[model samples]
Target: MVYIDKEKLKEIYPPNFRLDGDIQKGYINEDGTIEGVFTLDGFEPCTLDGMEGLWNEEKRLFIPNEVAEQGAKSLVGAPILAPTPKIENIREFFEKRYSMLDCYFENDESVYNLSTDEDVLKKYEDSKTSFVFLSIDMVKSTELSLKLPLELNSIFDNLFLNEIASIIRGMGGYVYKSVGDELIAFFEPANLLNKVDDSILCSDYIRVFILDYLNKFLEKNNLPQVGFRTSINYGEVYVKNVGDKLELNGYNLSATIKLQNFAKDNEIILGSNVVNIANKKWKSRMKKLKVNPRKLKKEGLHEGMKVYRLHNLEGRYD
Candidate 1:
């Protein structure tokens, strides 16, 4: 996820900017003045300098217009854009232009059985797509969910999904699916070194962002705290959409999820695939770990796959 200084944003756009819908539908004239809306926090929609881009709902930051353009380009998986009118509306522009995959939360009851939904199957023909897969799960979610009222639990889930997914999108990653407490997402693959850099930066930012966001969330709502464990892998996977629903299936996707089992709270696990493509700086932060598949019984992992954990972020931004 792209990290923006909240105080810096307020200085840039002031307190009156507006954030609405999925995108920040407002105004950014040529003079550098911004007049629009912003989602300051996941649930609170407020006005600010209107920039024609997306917003990271949980973190309450508008994506820079340039970054949004980059995200758009990546979403299309194409090299060049034909001359076209500038897109002012985020949802209208993206929905009309890009075929986005679907996301789910853990408690969702939608059956994954392809045979049961023939109509759905017909709508979402599969295609091979390359992306960097990020699979994350909230630690001790069952106990936490049980402690809260169902309505409040729903609020928490919604908050997590909106913020987390928005951060991914802002960083040019697409959320493929979110089931139960597990969220699966991917970044588009590119031959460009900058794109690879962005993917690693996004992962780093997310690791820090979640720790900070959850603390504030729990404190604001008077709820108990929670933790995150993430595993990232990069490769090709079969992606399909049925109606508005999107799903990912393939070995790479499964491998990413399985790798998460070895992670501890507040840790970011990187699969060998992610490590292979990451820059030297990122690679240096990874420490190799050996896994025993016997410990994962039903997790369906092959024996002796290597995974790495990112470490020492405390002084990273210092």
Candidate 2:
């Protein structure tokens, strides 16, 4: 189990600085605690051994352990282990491969669970937030659905969609909406720098998973490989609650969707705003996507709108 040592953080960072980057993306339970990692300065992000309180997976934010217990008791024996469906293998993968990540999954069926809970929806109710939005969809879903049995297709969809959703949740992003093989997720607004960094990191991790693990699994099973197209953007969006649901309306979201549509399979794209505000080192790693000016639409896009892709994937960065 790990928690944040805020005093150490306060000393290193200024009074105005805040970081809530969740790497382990795990949760602390009533019986025990899960590990997590939070970032801090430069490439030297402070590793979060854990949070001081309960790591609410549904809310994707830390909450008081007392309140967590109350909510857990209210659920009649269901300990609020972030309710993000912590799968054991997923947890093991992070523990072995990425030391900077905090993941708390140890259960199944939690992959598809997301922001529908009251606790999550309440915070964003009738509010405007500046967040990093990421959109992705499987490239081969349509073709697979056409050629394969519905049952087999559904299984494949679930496998691919749930894996990506798990990564989003683990990276401290929220998966509020997933349709078929497509997903729309966002990083929290409290700390945009780490969030943007996390967004790019999340995309790279997904790509690596496709290139390494998923592809191997598909090959072993004699199944075709698949990949996703990802696009990320940043801006303020209004979260309006209607009939106990969240409706996010904004140009950022729309443009992110458009950017995803323009991405090639297995590609990760970033909007201009994200490129402009990203850490300087990361900015150096990205290159603008070339396209016919007439093909790219201006609606819901920034002036001199440009899309970007990571030019360096030769190795993990320091």
Candidate 3:
């Protein structure tokens, strides 16, 4: 059975970081002490070896075992892990090989089990991964829906699921979640520097492709035009498997959704985290705008809370 060195972990995290819940079978020593337990938050049952710490109950921010030991009040005073690691290649491998629904089912088998099997649940444990979160929403969706007939709505939906989503996947990104006309995607860049570049390339490609191709498809079928806006931020998130499917949720994901509201129609807006890792080449494609510094004070980004608007995808190398 897999086990954690409880004493070592505690020493790193301090008194408040207590282990709760039942210890897994066979991990209890003859002394009746349980040193390790299964996690519902990692890609594999043994992936904690790569993580330095855990998030608190509120899921506000990651608390490194070392910082917790130092009596750090929260992640603000402590140094949280910046970009989450792309620990597994599951999405990148399967997305191109299968349809979105098929890919989701292949990775999230816990949803198919009819019995309450511990092994099945264990097989579905989520992995904590670092990724770039990109949220795309159709601009004036309600108004557009009202104007379109049922056939046109169907056409638009097909364009998103087939065309737009495929473009993202082709660029080594995943359209992990969606609601109505909005899509929430995650891109696992190899390193911090690649996060902004990857997101920019995908977003720019989607924008240009839709403007060029989608319009032609609509014209051929005698339909109206549509526009969209994309917002992106990068950080750690839990890719969890529940009853019917996998879900991506965490502090960073939530923040990205909120950031999406700040984007104007047909524009791609980036958060501070993306801006921080962006190089001169990536930054050149965008124009930086300042946010209300006072509004960002609580999030530890007040010093320079800026968002960048994409100017054009032209001249981008990759």
Candidate 4:
């Protein structure tokens, strides 16, 4: 059974009283009394005193199936007088919950299941396409980590990671993994080749966005500035569905790592493929902004070698 994030549920019932037990175990009866066996901290069926204080007609409760499976209570109650939760907030809650559980949250479980099947693999063997991989690493992460106090460091990490993930999602990219001070993302060639021009445009916009966002956040918090070196690569990568998880295998991964290593201080480097689509005009713009752009030599790149650079900015990327 799936579990909803408790924090998200709290947001939905902002001002209402929440029963403290696992919500899935309880359910509401037709008459409005909680009927199941679930434990409720502030509710007492014997007295019905708490019931009097609860909103009657507009009340709603969220119950997970696990609680019900445990033979817990049924009629957990919550007033619905609060505003409806935003879709984005709901998405974030689920994402955070799954991340905390160290589980992959499939947007479409059915698709994942079907794609991973042996029969499906035989049918779509040749039809499967590859993806481009990109990694963004925080520069001097150890130094930056040391500069911030423990409490502040935790706050900064949470804020920065979420911001970066949101940006990638907004740009139609998938975040493969988010490690200590870095995140890896992927772009499917099938989705990108159609609008190659748009993809290039989006990439540049996102890089600038990250730089600006970090700068502003640091300035506002009066924290030491932090910068990032990003490496992006394109190649034929095998994307496979493993149960509920998606995995990528190919040179793109290694290429992105190599590009990251090649990135100079406050500079962005582009692979031949990326430069072909982006053109020298974009490089000139970076120069005018005092951002240097370098081309990686063939010897410096590998089979999946792509583009990379360090972000230098005066303010945060909005």
Candidate 5:
């Protein structure tokens, strides 16, 4: 009973006959004429002489021949709407509907339908493609968390977190979620020159940037110098939206946590995969830049583990 607007039909339709009414019920003809009983859930293909019922019982969505043709060209498949009483006021309708579903609307206006399994799967798939997972925190955030006054702590968190988030965004990465002092970011492979290269570059840049920034902050505020450590990994992650809330899923989460656990003071640890790619691509450049590249012992270290020790110009660890 939910009739689509005639104008909107063009937007949804593919190149073919201009359909104006329900093609499944034999109402609208190829030339945009309405005939027969114009009752249809949506649209479908019909091999019958005039009109035919081409309902998709599995999807609970109708697809008329005209709409189906459009779908074929546009790759939209079909347009399905849930059967319900149409409310007059759009805002009131949505508010009441979401309330009835125990969902809250956000400023972002992203609608999350909790009833559909496909919706959930699509959400998970989208997240997997768009996120990079990294775990970043001060070398000893627990110790530092207790050292400063409540006000100073708040200031530090705000300043440093905002700066770090901005830096991630500047590097074409998205900070999807943060836990206290730790953050997870997603870097689009398309945005980077190469996924592995960009990941390493960003990781190294952030590590050094945070350290240098903190040193300056300490000097300016007359506080003790603070340092940080980080770990990064790459993998497909699902980004999910629960109403207004968003989350990321992938190896980035587990890899980041593992990296953080293995992170030593004043250093950044990258996943074995990242290290392998970096060693192959940037090994020569690393040597030219005077970076001491050492392969972690295969027997002692897991396969694919490569460690780079930052050193001074004299080849001494700083």
Candidate 6:
């Protein structure tokens, strides 16, 4: 949430400045002459930069813009909503779900089962391609979906997906799939090292963008805030087209999802393979995460294998 100094704004809004300080109207713009300064408590006063008409749907009120999110809402100052399922609960949650997630790890060759539709059968070719996979799971989305009307839920989901996809593409990654409450993307192997770095970097951008920017924007509007977890892994996968969409199957992809499941809200988990290939700066930020050996092997990961998390984030998983 943010506030403006009504007295000060009244001084600025007049014949010199035509618009008022109403954020709901989304009308306010000025160089140095006339401006409505927004202050997020405990942070320095700042302004949202852009032409007028901020309420325009394109402005995306919640999250507003990069300038709006970062300007007044500092990453450290943004109100982080830590709902139910604390760190200990996250550990217990994954431990209990091992049985449910076994299918992803049961087979060494993680090939996608061909779709039954006859028309797209030929598109399911045997060719395999290497990709650095990134998975981001929105936390508590199911609860929000159940509570919100269907159309409203979709609006929120699309808001998230569209913003997230922009971040991924900005880092030169391709969005492979977006399932309910989960976003899966791929970076090509043509430039493996850089792609791995790109995949790892996505988490950082997303962390601040969601927690500091989007969530704050939503909170200001009196809407529910959301959180997410991300995982990155690198490997080869069989790629096929099913109804104009790319479907991928690979052991590493499953491993990515498994790692994401274990991550806490606002957390980024890295598979050992991703760490091995990631640049030194990114690797330096990670603290090894321990997991049950039996469950690790069941997820196509081996005993004594390493999983990593950004050590700076608050969590007991390390």
* Highest-scoring model, lDDT: 2
Q: Which tens-of-lDDT digit does each residue in 1-318 have in candidate 4?
A: 223345655565433223333333445555555544443333322212322221222233423433322222221242211111122353454344334321112232221210112332233343445555656777787887788787667555555555555555555566677778677776544433322323333455445544555555466657777676665555565656666555556665656656666665434444444443332334333321222234434534443433334234333442
Q: Each model's TM-score, in the order given?
A: 0.57, 0.64, 0.56, 0.48, 0.49, 0.57
Residue-level lDDT tens digits of model 2 in 109-210: 534454433455458778887878888888978897998787767667766766776677777787868777888888876655667877887777777776
Report the poorest 10 consecutive residues by lDDT, candidate 1: 77-86
Model 5 segments beyond 4 Å from truth?
A: 1-131, 191-193, 279-281, 284-318
* Tens digits of lDDT, candidate 5, 1-318: 222334555555442322222223333344444444333333344444354435545444444445434322321222211111122343453233323221111222232211222333454544446334556776566776689887666555544554555455545456665667666665655422244454555565565555555455456657656666776666566667667555555544665565555556766566544443342334333321121223223123433444343223121223
Q: Which portions of model 6 miss their true places by more than 4 Å? A: 1-125, 241-245, 298-300, 313-318
Cα shift from native, residue 22, model 4 (Å) = 59
Per-residue accuracy of model 3 over 8-76 as CA lDDT, tens digit each: 556544433222222234243344333344222321222245765445443234444433333212112
**Distance from true location, Cα of 211 in model 1, Å:** 1.7
Best by TM-score: 2
lDDT string, candidate 1, 74-162, tens digits: 22322221111132443453343222112222444341211222242333357776667777778888888899899777656655555
Off by over 4 Å in 2: 1-118, 298-303, 315-318
Cα lDDT computed for each candidate against the true fold:
0.57, 0.63, 0.56, 0.46, 0.46, 0.59
- Superposition error at 209 for model 5 (Å): 2.1
Candidate 5 C-alpha RMSD relative to the actual structure: 19.4
Lowest summed-lDDT stretch of 10 residues in model 5?
75-84
Residue 93 CA error for candidate 1 (Å)? 22
Cα deviation of 287 in candidate 6 (Å)?
0.8
Model 6: weakest 10-residue lDDT segment is: 77-86
The TM-score obtained by model 2 is 0.64
Which rank order by TM-score, best down to worst?
2, 6, 1, 3, 5, 4
Residue pairs with backbone atoms closer than 3 Å in model 6 (clashes): none
What's the lDDT of the predicted structure labeled candidate 4? 0.46
Estimate candidate 3's alpha-carbon lDDT, on a 0 to 1 scale.
0.56
